[model samples]
Target: MKIKKEFPSIKVNKEDQTIDVKSESNVGKKESKGKVGSEDMQNYFEQLNEIKKRVVHLQKIVRRFLKHVHVTEFRWKSVIGINDAALTGIICGSAWAIKGSCIALLDQNLKLKIRPEIEVIPSFFHAESKTNLTCILSFRMGHAMGAAIRLLTYWRGSKRTLVNKPQPLESKS
Candidate 1:
């Protein structure tokens, strides 16, 4: 469909094939202009729409990244053999700082089992103010253990089977 546009000054000459489009000289025309074209408003809306789309895409990526981070962090903490209490403390701290909540150390079996041993150690030896050799060693071992556990777990997939308990022998008749 051919779209016909109307102009204030231009008249279409029907006699000839060539239409003479005219321009009324506003060359020295006094500006009685108040508000002009709505083009600016349309452009602003388009720009805002583009920005909204980008923001949504960025939010999606951030959500996915956070999910992976929380899962990996919780898994590593469990493997490191830190007691549930310590792990809980760490996760709580992380949650306070970051957006997503961390998984509780008590929720995992390994953290629940090992945390008692960590807690049993004397606080004087591993005081936060002073770093003793035992504390240093323990921290290093914990980090390494956590990393190793994470890799092992990843390799093993979802279900991990540890040592099988021995079956009790039946009494002879």
Candidate 2:
């Protein structure tokens, strides 16, 4: 006898700004473990509005946490292709070309790449290895106090954010 099992997976597509969650569950069985209750659902914008509010709150916490974060070292080395030298050369060249912009973007968001304490190093090796990657990233210990303070302060602020804006009525054509 063989047992049949399934796994769950979640994929995020940044370009499309969408998330795909896939899972196989025995919800229809006599005893279901992952049943969604009716009370957890809303008819329309209520759910989406609540989700939006949560996203905003989470973003605030992340930004506060990031403010406390500092990168001390970032190093990545990759070598592509073994049998085909042309492919390896092209990939290596492309990686080198994009390295500057990648670092610039990193610095723009983190604001630590250019600091004297940070060591940013990226390299492309054309040695024998179909695909190989070596990366080392070291960041200073981020204090959770800032994020905690921001969370508490947000709750103490005005209730304007909690007031759900009225959803625009849809036109019936």
Candidate 3:
């Protein structure tokens, strides 16, 4: 008995341990139609209008939600430590808190104000007897908090607005 090999568009030889390969040169070329028709253009514009309508609806919903929702309290904290020698180090911690409310207007603008309270604590290992605590009321934390809240609110609102809507049925004539 002899072993035989075969493949589509290929020739294999087991006796001589050789294979023949073939490629079509016209495989890269495709026939092109003349031009886009008026119906195709009409369909494209209709789809665009539908998308615009959905976007407007989403914006209205977001604006309404923003107008009613308010942030009553916010807080953030961070700590850092450094060691200059094997037995000694310095440690520091800071925190900020803000309380406020905001309202979003019909023109997609926001009105907001916040009062922030900040605290800082520091300690040095070399000076074991010395530890300090400081407190202050400032406007900087208010700005930072406002920006953060706006960013988070818009992100969450956009996520909530993304719902799958049913596509219109097409008449297959």
Candidate 4:
């Protein structure tokens, strides 16, 4: 049986070798030909608003954490040193490897195409005496993690919506 690419709502049962089609009129009573119903559009807008609210809430939490956290001490070693170089190399290598593995797994399992671009910017705080030191390590780490979580959430949400979208009904005579 030939499946029409234009009609994505039709599903073919491979086991029984049968095609199931639903009528488009049954989807929404007010919907006109080639046009979505007002109710459906409103529902879509509502969902988008909900998503935006959730994202804003998440941002507020992150901001609160950043504002309240206090870091007591921070030490930055020279990368020219053998130990520092080794440690940096290990950390950077491990992070890239994990990202690569995750991309590979996602591609293999979900057929997702993802290209990851990572950039690290280094910032330094210098004080005259060792006693006067204020570090923002926790804040920086929290911000990074929060951003990563937000990105993952958005990706997953979009993918889920795309994959689980309701199929439109096939027109009936």
Candidate 5:
């Protein structure tokens, strides 16, 4: 009891404060970390997947466009009327065959329903069985022509189609 002590015990006084500051600080840090860590990772992965899907979709669209272009170009170059009358005849004949196949599968019940929309079908189909056959043949011919155009060509839209029409040659002086 006689010697005086040089060091004293440090006391943290908390009586004046309403809340514990240390606990509050720790909670804030944890919340901030949670937002930047797992949450950001989740969002990043989602965005990456979305971009991949979009790229694939765009690739398919581009491929289809290219195919259509090729078809249009081929039609312009090789088709008759659209190029030679002989080619047109062949295309119509093929379309007729396809039409026959479609009619065979569809039968009379379905044919009656579709008849109104098909105005160009031949009326001479006397046989119940032959009606669908004839209709199918007609449809096939048309479809063949479309397929030919698609396979053989590309067009620069309606303007190109208009400009390509038949024109008479003028004599020079």
Candidate 6:
């Protein structure tokens, strides 16, 4: 009685075994009229549909982003000349291998990963004295946003699971 007096919002109905809190929005609504099982099934389906819609939408956005994620409008290039043939050869070999590096590294896990693309443009020796090189690496903003969203979702889900218990609409009557 004291608790009810203190918290009028709490509706402890012991008859139907449902404890629903009263809000201004649901004050006059028939939230407790239907059979509990039927209502629960309906709500479960509604929630499932909502989740499916959101997940599909998220998937579409992610795929579209993966296609045009990198902005080619702005490109950074570095041109250098190495005097030593051995050093130049080593650098060229490394660049060649790395240029072919693809998203195969992270795509298997989430199919939701991004790898920055690098292009190496090598030029023949001007006078056989120096090897000219143009190396470009382009990264996209979408990768950061995708990573942030993934981390936040993982954190929210784990936190909710570890810290909260399944409460029956405030307190089960």
Q: For model 4, how does the per-residue alpha-carbon lDDT over 1-173 read when each residue is reduced to its tens digit? A: 21112222444557655455432333333322232444545666777656555454555554554454443333222211123545555555554566567545433433222233333222222211111111222235655676657645654344434322433433211
Q: Give the TM-score of candidate 4.
A: 0.21
**What lDDT does candidate 1 reach at residue 124?**
27
Query: Top model by TM-score, which number?
Result: 2
Which tens-of-lDDT digit does each residue in 1-173 have in candidate 5? 11111111222335632221121123223211111234334555665555334343444443443333311110001111224445545654655666566545444312233332221222232211112112221123444466545533443233323322222111110
Give the Cα error of residue 97 in candidate 5, in Å: 1.4
Q: Which stretches of candidate 6 lie over 4 Å from their true place?
A: 1-76, 102-153, 156-173
Runs in model 4 with CA error above 4 Å? 1-83, 118-173
lDDT of each: 0.32, 0.47, 0.35, 0.41, 0.32, 0.42
Cα shift from native, residue 81, model 1 (Å): 20
How well does model 1 score by local distance difference test? 0.32
lDDT: worst 10-residue window of model 6: 1-10
Answer with 3 or 4, whichever has the higher lDDT. 4
What range of 10 consecutive residues in model 3 has the weakest lDDT sum?
Answer: 94-103
Task: Candidate 1: give the clashing pairs.
Answer: 83-115
lDDT of 6 by residue, 1-173 (tens): 01111122444457876544542223333232212344554665675555444343555545554564432232223233366656667766676565444334334323332334444444335313222222222446667587546534634232323222223432322
RMSD of each: 33.7, 13.3, 26.8, 23.4, 36.9, 24.4
lDDT for model 3 comes to 0.35
Global CA lDDT computed for model 6: 0.42
Question: Using Cα atoms with residue i matched to residue i, what is each candidate's TM-score against the true structure?
Answer: 0.16, 0.39, 0.21, 0.21, 0.20, 0.26
Q: Which regions of candidate 2 deviate over 4 angstroms?
A: 1-53, 113-143, 149-173
Instruction: Note the clash tally of each candidate.
Output: 1, 0, 0, 2, 24, 0
Which pairs clash in the backbone of model 6?
A: none
